[model samples]
Target chain A: MTQQPTAAMLAIGDELLSGRTKDKNIGYLADAMTLAAIELKEVRIVADDQEAIVEAVNALRARYTYVFTSGGIGGTHDDITADSVSAAFGLPCIYNDEAIKRLAENYARRGIEFNESRRRMARMPEGAALIDNPVSTAPGFVIGNVHVMAGVPQVFQAMLANVIPTLQGGVAIISEAIDCPFGEGDIGTELAAIQKAHPHTSIGSYPRFSDKGFNTQLVVRARERALVDAAAIDIRAMIAALQG
Target chain B: MTQQPTAAMLAIGDELLSGRTKDKNIGYLADAMTLAAIELKEVRIVADDQEAIVEAVNALRARYTYVFTSGGIGGTHDDITADSVSAAFGLPCIYNDEAIKRLAENYARRGIEFNESRRRMARMPEGAALIDNPVSTAPGFVIGNVHVMAGVPQVFQAMLANVIPTLQGGVAIISEAIDCPFGEGDIGTELAAIQKAHPHTSIGSYPRFSDKGFNTQLVVRARERALVDAAAIDIRAMIAALQG
Candidate 1:
């Protein structure tokens, strides 16, 4: 069987690192990529430094099938993701005519002046394709495998919606969760044995402790439903044996 | 004044990457680190793969003053963080007597069997010191510059409380927020000029759009209060000019 298309995310901003902002994009992108059958391999959140952004972009782009970046695409001085991405790809960051025209029209309709700073949104790496942004007219861009989108949660999500459908995806990974009455310490041994027995499927045990109670949840995941089911059965039996 | 101690975070687990769990630790840690006067430079989330964990651990540990890791420290099969940390440091992973006895007593008091799988939590790189986990008895460990903590938010926060005081920190970064009536597009030009003028500080303008309304929040951050205040004064004057 062929490997699924893999993705990595670069969240660029000082606001996120300074704890002034909580990240809404990583979880959103992870959930979206999982549903699209594109495996999200890694995610890196870096400050709005061009060197750091360029380094992370180059590293992840070389490894993953696709690299999606969120944040740093606005009109302000800190919005340097587009230029950094261009540097990563060794291309000149340019103000594309199509993007500039679209953005100009959008601003003109709203009676907002399309000033030089506002026009900065139209800058993209040379030979890049635009990703549609329905929420706002400032389009995200795709250069090579890197997709640079907006930092705002709504805009990032909207641009991602337009990007996911275009990517090639493989079989969806299925997951089954069985809640064990006992804790992870109680079932960790047999669970390891079961996971070793079914090498193809991946098993993860999560212990939940809340005001309600404490219980262990065993998650089984695989591309094929049969493999996931097979591992899940052993997990249930392991819990049952502990009860017996 | 000397630079603040820099830190990087590695969030490890398949559950996080698969979107089975939305991470609460990164934001919490970022907030805590910022308050402690330690700069959190970068954060990476990787699956529970040993090679990935080892590589990230080494890379971050090499660059930053401290490397804090969350997740993959439980008793289950997927908990490979302890072993990976040992590999990264080229040390032997062993069950420390102090950690083992502490965990054993905690389980014994709770009338739970301290099985081999439970004892697995005591495994840490050689010459590592234990970080206290008051909520759960399975103590996290600190080896060299890396501090390994639990994945659960409650326990991770608890463990971090114990670890933070031991580290050295510098001057706190002061941030001042000025709420602008206009949007980012309206102020991006003058904002850029202000940011360029105050090259020593970082100025970020975030657009807020909700049922309440649309506004831009301009944040100024610097190690010294005067730099931040001066920048804020410039930012406010610029906004006033825009209104005029």
Candidate 2:
């Protein structure tokens, strides 16, 4: 039997840590992965330090089928993602001849000087393939199972859009929700029982306070369409019988 | 000398791991902590499993000055954060009389049935103090340094707003950046020199592709305004001399 494709996301930036920036990348990529049927199993947010990036990449890559890393790929002093990824795999950092050629061409068209620092973007881990960045010329790359993308949301999303299409996917997961006016304790035991009976289905309850009263949101999820529907049916019935 | 207040973020949800949801809570809380002058040192995201939450809470709380958790505190079957935190410290889950009273009264105004499931939101750890949730009636709570908050962004933000103003903060960290038109290797040595010169400041070198070609973005960060400004100036001057 073929194993399900699993992914891990590593978000790197000190700005994220200091709360200077809100990371929108994780959710965007997560939704993208879900749409593509790639299961995102884990996410880690690490500082933009070389040691941390290297360690995280090495660890996550070995554990998951695919690893998607965002941030720290820019031309900033805080951007050390590429070098760290290379070091993590003991690969040499070298300029991708094709990337450099394209970058130089793009710069020429834009009438921008392909300065030394700007030219540095073409450098990537040896043997890695470039993931195109349409929003900007800075190309994201794939080294082994790790896909290193840009940090800026626009460029990152563009790169990811290009990268995800190339990968294989599994059955797309779907979800549904039912609002229950009852408290969680009234149904916690039964819900746990339902979960145990249907191990494949993912069930969750979210409680919110509305002007009418505090309401509980029971969410059901599954990779199989039938199972999700069945779970929702059972869940709605349980809530109705117990509360209504 | 006074030690800085530190905080860690704990995001609890299977939705996060499933990639169905992107976490805004951590980034939001991190920003709030920074604004309050607290140092956010670490963040951990665990699935909505009891053991996972308990283990994470126990481990993180001991290391950081405070642990703020979001998600899984709702009134759903998946909402086990309160119990998990309580279990971690061997505390019992009990309905807060005050919470139950308030919840009942609040629901009465709306003419909604205060079902048993909804009452679960009123459950608190034996000694937990409720953190006011202005956006919603289901209050967040604080036990020692661990603050349990709602997962919904608006509610979470409001809940955090209620808590942040009361916490102690330290000097706000600041940053500055300069673009260098050089490859990472070309300036690696000089960059090392800068890092050594400003040990208190964090210097990051990111290599990226720009319209001008590959450029490096060098960022210097420090808590002291004067030091950060000085480092930025020196960094720019060094890059200038390197390019020249």
Candidate 3:
């Protein structure tokens, strides 16, 4: 069996760190990566500072198969992802003629001037490939295994669509969720034994407490469908026994 | 001026990384910390992995004044946060009699068995201080500067209330926002000048595109209210000039 490709996500913006903006990109990327059969192992949210962005990009890209960064790729003064990504790789960030042309055409269609600030979106790290943004004209870029994307949800999602097809995917992970109306304490020992018996599958027990009362959701995940099914069956039987 | 008390947040759970759960704790903590005059510097989301949890805990605790971790403190087999935190500090993780007493009493009142799995919630690192969980009976703990809390939103928020008051805070950061009906490219240069003129303040321009039209919200934040207001005035003037 081939190893699944691992990925790490970096969410960059002061808005996120300051709680001025709630991040929507991480969950979107997580779901997309799961469907693409990529294992998103770690996610980090950092501010707009260039040093922080460079440090996070270098660390994540080294540790994972692919590193995806969202935000700090706009035309504003704080949009420094391209510069930081370039610094991480020791590459010169320069304006690409193709990006410039695309931006100019996009602005012209909207009857707006492609001014210097908007023109800033044309900049890319040397040797970087541009990721298309269907929602907006400003293009994201890929330097090595790291893909830099816009912070805007629409642009980020569109850019991801352009990038996902270009990557290699492994076996898709299969998951099964069982709602068990038992507390974690009631099922902890039996759940551990079930987890031990099915070493191939990863079982997660999430306890939910509401006015309706305490309930637990046992999520079983594995690369093999048969293994997930087997583990889930045992979990169901255990829950049934506890209730009986 | 005293340095602002900085914090880092670690959101631990496979559910978050797998997109099965959307994290609410990070944003909640971020806003609470901001209001309390604490700076939230970084946030990380990692799966239920021991090594990863230990590494993140060690790194954040070393870098920031306070480290807050949410999740993985439940009674399930996958709840390994206490063990990982103990390993990070090289401290022995043992069941605390006080915590056990509290859990037993709470369970007894509810007519629930304080079984081994539920008993697991009483385990903490040696010499750790307990943080009260007002919502749930399971108490979180503080070992050194790291405050470990539950993954459940209600429990996490309640634990945060207990933890926030215990920390020393610095000067409260004041922020002002101005909504500009202009694209980022149109306001980029002027915004950069405004940011440079107010060196003590951090200016962030967030662009929004919708059916209403392209707009930008310029957020100016600083430890001093005067400086933030000053920056916001300049930004508002720039927007008015552009519109005129």
Candidate 4:
């Protein structure tokens, strides 16, 4: 809370690596981190291997203020992220009583038995805190700087949103978008010039698939809304003049 | 083709690192590489800085069989990916003749003027072969093992699909999924046993957001469908018994 928090996201899944599923957790976390004024520094997607998860978690935890990981927290064989992270921190994995009760009660509401495998969801590293999962009761856990959560995009997102608000924020996000007909090269040099003119703003250009045609969406974001809007207006005028 | 085809994905943009964009490119490329039988060992997401792109491309090109980059190939100021790749390869980035012709023709059909900024899309490293873009006219290019493409998920995906058929494939994808009611801990020991039982199958468990309650989806993947299926059957039976 003293210094601005910077975070890293590690997405663990072989399915993601094999392209069986599009991992949307990273984007969801990124947006949430930005909104909380926490800087999202790096994201790594590694296969669900203990060594890989351990290595990534260690590296990110050392470099960034916090590490937010999604996936590999399940009861199945490959869900080794929590164990690996616990190992990295030299912490013992233990069953969290609070998490177990919460998950069991959630299942009881649906008249479903909280089986042994389901009970495994309650395990957390010693000295860890449980992250609330209102959408699903299998609570994400925080150990040291690493927060381990479900890989399911929706659930992971919900958990992250719930957690991020409790963290301290430094800046609010303000951005403006300009739909430009100009292709990249024609406006490349001038755009570069404009960026040099405004050192504080973060300029982004996203090429969108539009019905009208391939259009470039140029966005300028900053802590200040007026600066963002001004930059966008100027950029839009520059694109129009280039077309003329 | 002569060597074990290797590929790496370079995701460029501040949005990604800032947590404004959770990247979909790495997962897409990983799957595409696996299907192509190409070894995808590493993927790095960097800010849209020319130096960072050049350094990453150079480092990856030396170590990898292929380096495919996404983002920064647009008309805006942050669209410096093409230039950086050119710098890394020590190739002159010129307004590609064929690309210009295509852009001009494509723009004419859409009744839009081909402005100078738009012409930036035509710039490519000297001697690079253009990768087909079915969804958009802004074609990606391949210089040696480096394939530079768009950042937008849909466009990047379409370009990947187009490029994959031109490459060789490794083992065909074969997989099976098992639903587990048990929590991760109770099945952790048994899941390890199942993995040991079938060393060839890539067994993984994903926690899904479920209406009934939190459930784990266990998947086994291999070159042989029957082998994968057999592993999944064992995994399911084990999970069921363990939960009971």
Candidate 5:
């Protein structure tokens, strides 16, 4: 891991790709990752296919410090994330006894059937640890660097909250946002020079077009506050000169 | 290439990964792709780095029938999607004469300077065709099967609308949503049986929990209406039987 622990998110589902469910998890996870001092490097939204899930999980887990996946952990036929993740790690998917006990007790209390279908929630890769889901009885599993969580937003959030406390985070990135009166075109060259000067700092320009014409938001980010502030100062100066 | 045209989205920007800017393009494009009779298979959000962009562009372009990219095509330091995409295709990113002409004319009408920075908007891969941008007049370009569009929602929409008409679309996928009174656990086994029975149709179960407890939405999707309808009927029957 670098100064900031890098992470890749795999948001798996068919509904997201089909436009049936607009993903609400990626942004939420991204925000949470930012707060935890994790550098979210990539996000891949793949289908519910086991092959797709396994392939993505293998690729992401190897590349990043942490790989977080949300979706397909339910008690349905399409919920193959656990099995796929197990396959990715070359482990057999098995019914975790602790997970099964919890699910069984919860279902019993709720007067629900603890049948094979519901029991699917207890499935995990062999030797994987569990991330407790307060909202749902089904526990998410952590195998190696990858953490597999629920597709439901509420459950995913709850599991994430549980996972955060256990993490030994890296340096938190500090940032500053400067609103530029001019468009990106007016300051692109100067912005490029500023970026070259601060190689370690990330400077991003966001342009918005409306009735007021184009105005850009310059965001400077770095592991240290002084680095971000310095870049922000340079960006503000560049914008001020361009406004002249 | 299949019955339904397949597409993969490459959302390029560092802001999205950093959680500084929530992505608005993926959902919009997913909806648009659905409407255009195209099946969106995968979505990858990568940073503004040239290497990441190039790698993702190459991977998605080869796998899907069409690869659509949004963001990082702006005239800013972080905006390197055009150059990266050109590199992916082994082509030189050149400033197109027609694009330059349009930008120059638009800027002249608005009494704005057509400076070197603004001229960066005219950059595209050699031998690429242009996609008209009705919003800001910065043209998107198409090289091979990849369509590069703006990051801005309005501009991306306009370019997509323009691109849709030009495409030879595949079979339109039809779908039906059946509201299940029971949770996924209650009907998972029967639903799986139904899904197994219908090989052509895709059956997905989505569960929601509130004060009312768990309720699932079963969506059936296929190339033809009959295939989707058949699976939906089976799902409805399973839900009704479970309810009784």
Candidate 6:
């Protein structure tokens, strides 16, 4: 069996840290990465400070197979992701001719002025590949393993679509869930044993309380479908025995 | 002005990393910390791995004034927060008699068995203080500067209420927002000047696209209300001038 590709996400913006903006990008990227057979192992949210961005980018890019950063790449003063990313890799960030042409054409077609701030969006790290943005003309860029994307959900999603197809994928993880009408305590010992038996699979017990009273959802996940199914069956039988 | 008390948050759960659960705890804690005159500096989301939890807890606790961790404090096999936190601090994790009594009473009152898994919630690092969980019977614990709370939204919020009042707060940050019907490029230069003028304040420009065309929300935040208002006035004037 091949090893699964691991990824980390960095959500950059003062808006997120200050609670002014609730981040939607992390969950979106998490699901997308999973579907692409890339395991998203860690996620970090940092403010718009350049030092913070550089530090997080360097750390995550080194630790994971891919590091995706969202936000701080727009046409504003706080949009420093491109520059910070360049700093992390010791690369020079300059305005790319292709990005400039794309932005200028989009602005000209809309009859909007291609002002300095708008032109700032054309800047990319040296030797970086541009990630296409279908929603907006401003392009995201990939430097080394770090993919810098816009903070806007529409643009980020679009850019992700462009990037995911270019990467190598591993075996997709299969998951099975069983809703057990019992507290975690009633099924934990048995659940642990099942987990022990299926060492390759991951068994998670999530407890929820609603009008129906306490309930637990046991999720079994593994790269192999047979392992997931086997573990799930054992979990179901254990829950049934505990209920009785 | 007094240095603002800074905090970091660690959201622990495989459900979150797997995108099975969209995290609501980070935003809630961000807003709560802001209101309490604390600045939330960073947020990390990690899976149900003990090593990940320990590393993040230790790193965040060392960097920020306070480290708040949510999730993994429940009665399940994946609930390894207490053990991980103890390991981070190099403290012995043991069952607290007080916590055990509380759980036993809550379970007995509800006619539920205090099984071994449920009893697991009573374990805490030696010399840690218990944080009240108003919504659930399982209590959270605080060891040193790290405050560990439940992963469930209701229990996490309830524990936050119990924890916030006990902390020392700094100068409250005041924020003002202005909605301008212009693209970020139209106002970026003037916004930069305004930000420079108010060195103590933080000005963030967020762009949006809707049927009404491009728009930007300029948020000005500072420890002093006068500085925030001043920055907002300059930003509003710049937008009005640009529109003219």
Highest DockQ model number? 3
lDDT of 6 by residue, B86-181 (tens): 999999999988899999988887687888988999999999989976456678998999999988776677677668768777855566768888
Could you give the CAPRI-style class of model 1?
acceptable
DockQ of each candidate's interface versus the true one? 0.32, 0.24, 0.35, 0.28, 0.33, 0.30
Off by over 4 Å in 5: A172-244, B1-3
Please give the ranking of all candidate structures by DockQ, highest first, separated by commas: 3, 5, 1, 6, 4, 2
Q: Encode model 2's per-residue lDDT on B6-112: one tens digit a residue.
A: 88888988888766566777877776676567878767777777886887799789988888899887665678888999998889989998888878976787576
Per-residue lDDT of model 6, residues A1-244, tens digit only: 5778999999999889888899999999999988998999999999988899899999999999999999988888878888899999999999989999999999999999999999999998999988999898899999889998999998999999999999888889899888899877777777878889999998898888653445788888998889988888888788778767
- What digit string (tens of lDDT, one per residue) describes model 4 on residues A112-194? 99988887788778889989888778889988878888999778978887778667677677877677885455566788888
Estimate how well candidate 5 is docked, as a DockQ score: 0.33
For B1-244, candidate 1 gives per-residue lDDT tens digits of 6877999999998888888899998998897778668989999999999999999999899999999999988888889999999999999999999999998887777678899899999999999999987556789999999999999886787677668768786765667778888876688888899989998676755454333445656777677889999999999888888889
After superposition, candidate 4 runs with Cα above 4 Å error: A1-4, A101-115, A239-244, B1-8, B15-44, B50-65, B86-139, B152-158, B171-244
TM-score of 6: 0.85
TM-score for each of the candidates? 0.85, 0.73, 0.85, 0.71, 0.84, 0.85
- Which candidate number has the best lDDT? 3
Question: What digit string (tens of lDDT, one per residue) describes model 2 on residues A72-182?
Answer: 777656678889999999999888998898889999999999988777788789999999887888798999999999888888888888987888998777788788886
Q: Which ten-residue region of model 6 chain B has the weakest summed lDDT?
A: B205-214
Across A82-180, the per-residue lDDT of candidate 5 in tens digits comes to: 999999999999999999999998888767779999999899999999998755668998999999998888678767766765665675556676878
Q: Rank the candidates by lDDT, best first.
A: 3, 1, 5, 6, 2, 4
Residue-level lDDT tens digits of model 3 in B1-244: 7888999999999999889888988998897778668889999999999999999999999999999999999888899999999999999999988899989988887688788999999998999989986456689999999999999886787677667658887855566767788877798898999989998776766554334555656667677889888898898889889878
Go through the candidates in order and give each one's C-alpha lDDT. 0.88, 0.79, 0.88, 0.77, 0.86, 0.86
Question: Which lDDT tens digits does candidate 3 get at residues A1-244?
Answer: 5777999999999999889999999999999999998999999999999899899999999999999999988888988988999999999999988899999999999999989999999998989988988888789999899998998898899999999999998789999999999878889999999999999999999988654446889999998899999999999899889878
Interface CA RMSD of each prediction in angstroms: 5.0, 6.8, 5.3, 5.7, 5.4, 5.4
**Model 3, A92: alpha-carbon shift in Å?**
0.7
The sequence of per-residue lDDT tens digits that candidate 5 reaches over residues B103-154 is 9999999999999889999999999999999999999999999999998889
Clashes of each: 0, 30, 0, 18, 0, 1
C-alpha positional error of residue A150 in candidate 5 after TM-score superposition, expressed in Å: 0.7
lDDT for position B208 in model 1: 48
